[model samples]
Target: MSEAPWWRGAVTYQIYPRSFMDTDGDGVGDLPGIIDRLDYVASLGVDAIWISPFFRSPMADFGYDIADYREVDPLFGNNDDFDHLLAKAHSLGLKVMIDQVLSHTSVEHAWFRQSRESRDNPKADWYVWADAREDGTPPNNWLSLFGGCAWQWEPRRGQYYLHNFLTSQPDLNYHNPDVRRAVLDEVKFWLDKGVDGLRLDAINFCFHDQQLRDNPPKPEDKRVGRGFSPDNPYAFQYHYYNNTRPENIAFLEDLRALMDQYHQVAAIGEISSEDSLATTAEYTRDGRLHMGYSFELLTDDFSAAYIRSTVQNLEAQMLEGWPCWAISNHDVARVLTRWGNGDASPQLANLLSAMVCSLRGSVCVYQGEELGLTEAEVPFEALQDPYGITFWPTFKGRDGCRTPMPWNNGINAGFSVGEPWLPVPAEHRALAVSLQESEPGSALHRFRAFMAWRRTQPALRLGDIRFLDTPEPVLAFTRRHGDETVLAAFNLSAQPVELPLDGIAGATPVNGHGLAQGTFADGRLSLPGHGALYARID
Candidate 1:
């Protein structure tokens, strides 16, 4: 297949800057550090890299709490360092996408700072602020994802400010036209800086109810993890008033308009809505966002039924929109441990890699995913994530997944000589990049080979996915592009499974990784546990 589109079927590597690779002696990974490692990232055969937030922040929610949108955080270096990274990545023929958190900003951001100073400040209405009730309670019953009430009482203004996350990360009043304009300006700044795209953080949270109305209680079974744990009271109520407002449509249109100005500059919005897949479809439809992904497949469930249901649901829900699928990200638990049984087998890792790429949408592979890294265990004393600290042991928030990327078996995994910001997993030493580089059958090597092979399949690249009627433990599907069809089948169980291939006959194996070898006869194929088979259908 000739290259269809820059984003169509392209694999994006998500790099959590603080944990990726530190070029300097500093504990944190900076833009210059990323520049130094661009060649390594490019060698993985990924089309692009999506760097997590490195914006100026107080590190309240790590870098998600943005203090400045146009400026790079000092810990990650200055503008020149970022420019150098962009240049180096482009030189390596890799597209660059920066994380843009438009939903909120750090309490220290100039706009929020001025807004909280007084009711009469020029930027007073910039953030979502409301007067407390006569009883001194918050204006609404909205809950924060980080825990407790979403509103934080600001004594200086004698009112509670809206914050869906940490109080330090106050929600922006997107209802205001000026706020929309300013956000668009921030997007333009990155596009002008030669960023090929943006990974919009919490894109669904950009708007809220205009009136200071209390959100209604959610029904007993309606709640699922958005950011807060189900045990937390924050998940008890419907988030109707706090986020995913109808007003967000226009803002998305505004965002899309700006992106359209530059050729091949794409925007992938992160739809963290209650019904994420539906919202993902809605957000990407009608030229709102180029593409968007939800948390449907990011959860702990690893089953053929769950995966098939999600893809089918999206196929049904999303018609004109494009989707981006990711099994692992910075915040979520690493997929290896999350989905892996006790063995933590390489066969399972290869299956996941193949499954993710075979989906119709674009794919995002996190930094250490190629190495099959599991979540690092962080003790309470060593906890760096404020979210994890707040709900210790019960939830133990995102820090487990944010550990330093293991580069080698050497001290600190070659991440930093000056002690890594977070401890590297001891179990990860054997799976380090240095060690994996030497092993041909390693997960890293499998990832490289799979991605290389994927580039050759038109059906896997831009075709539509059609599920075949197969029995339990077997997932059979066809990815078809015009007349070229690739029949892909996977045995998701630990025992052998025989799956029938009806109607279409004459299938031959293409020698995919970890698949059981068998000849096709009488329109049937035999597969072993954790096996996969790919063939070009005639």
Candidate 2:
């Protein structure tokens, strides 16, 4: 275990820079602010920090719509600030990873600007431009993930450009050798900056079917299980042609080749497609990427069986590829509320953290999760996400999760002196970092204590997981590595439960982990509500 790569089983803390902290009081968090909070991030005892996009952008989809890959947006300070942040994070023993949105770029990007100018410009065909059908409709029936057709008309070019997301974010044509070369060079710009890793955003969307074939209609019953809701038109189709094309394999190899040149640099791609699990397996196989995470674990399924099946499915397919799991992120509602089931508690939060971390893979823990922050309620009047504005009451986009972080109980939860980009809910203020830090029994303290303790257990970190058969609301597994075997079990509900360890070998309860402890005696295991048990098999 000591010889394993630093990222093999690391717990990465995902920091949403726009909501992390606002040092300049511009109502948005900046790189300098992240740098200032590096100490606090270090205190969490995480192995790495994955900062969401800070690249220059027009804020069309926040920083996802990048106008320039090489420049840091003035809203987030210049390259100097990022350099300082990186240096400080390294000094604090935190590996730094930045979001790399390669599949698309903002409409304002110079390449897109020139490409949209005319059909034969120097940068023409830099993006996915297709002629409209005879009826003047979009070339195909493909739908944008942000609603409406994926194509946007350009009067200057007399053609439509593809945007898998918002209209302002144009998809790059990876088929174009020049475009691929340019994007690779842009990525190299970061590698040159000494970044330890890259969190690839929508990496599977890099290529579209060259023929632009229409996607097949999906069965209504199958639509909701994926990341999108039933209300989203995007879930109506199987989405075969628009993304996760065969061509992406080669490009990922090229990316991996470039990364191989650097020392211990890693890449973890975010994948969403028709079969995200299969694609996650393929993308991480054969040295394509260091690790890959799909939206499978990020969904609203809180059932113990679902979690077991999801991990087992991937484990069966991803023989050679490493996997990364996340329960929450800048996108989607926070896992606490999504999985809380009406009655949630600090004990439940601690159990959830332990459960996800104990899974057989590296983990990404979202910011404010240490304090067990639930989803915020951002009103329509204060909403900034265009996706939410487009899909009102039914689907509230990701603003609830992207609201400014609560650092303290002071005004605006100490996120900023100015009005926050999204209003912080009064509920979040009560669980602010400062308040949690003062109370040793708080979620924050337990999380830190667990993380610190987790480091001492090598089997929990890199051990191979074998799930044991148990009834609902109880998840039991054994982690085996080297000559050591550790048994872990969790109660996934707010009510007490008892299960028999029938035919199981003797186990001595391993204490020191900060969750509610369970009892193991006479081959019977008793767990309190939201309780977890860890034992070393004798």
The lDDT leader among the candidates is 2
Per-residue CA lDDT of candidate 1, range 1-538, in tens? 5556689888999999998888778888888878877888998889999999998999988899999998889999998888988998999989999999999999899998789889998888889989888898888789988889998999899988999999889999998889899999988999998999999999999998988688888777876674456578877887787889998998899899899999898889988777888888888887799888788878888888888888999989889988999999988888887778664777777778788889998999989888888888888988988888888778788888899888999779988878888888788877899999999888888888888878777789899999987777777788999888888888776677775678668776787443344345678888877778888787
Model 2 ranges off by over 4 Å: 225-229
Q: After superposition, how far is residue 117 of candidate 1 from its true place, in Å?
A: 1.4
User: lDDT tens string, model 2, 406-508?
Assistant: 9999879999999899999888999999999999999999999999999998898999999999989999999988999999999998899987976466998
TM-scores of all candidate predictions against the true structure: 0.97, 0.99
Write down the RMSD of all candidates, one decimal each: 1.5, 0.9
Report every candidate's CA lDDT. 0.85, 0.92
lDDT of 1 at 101: 96
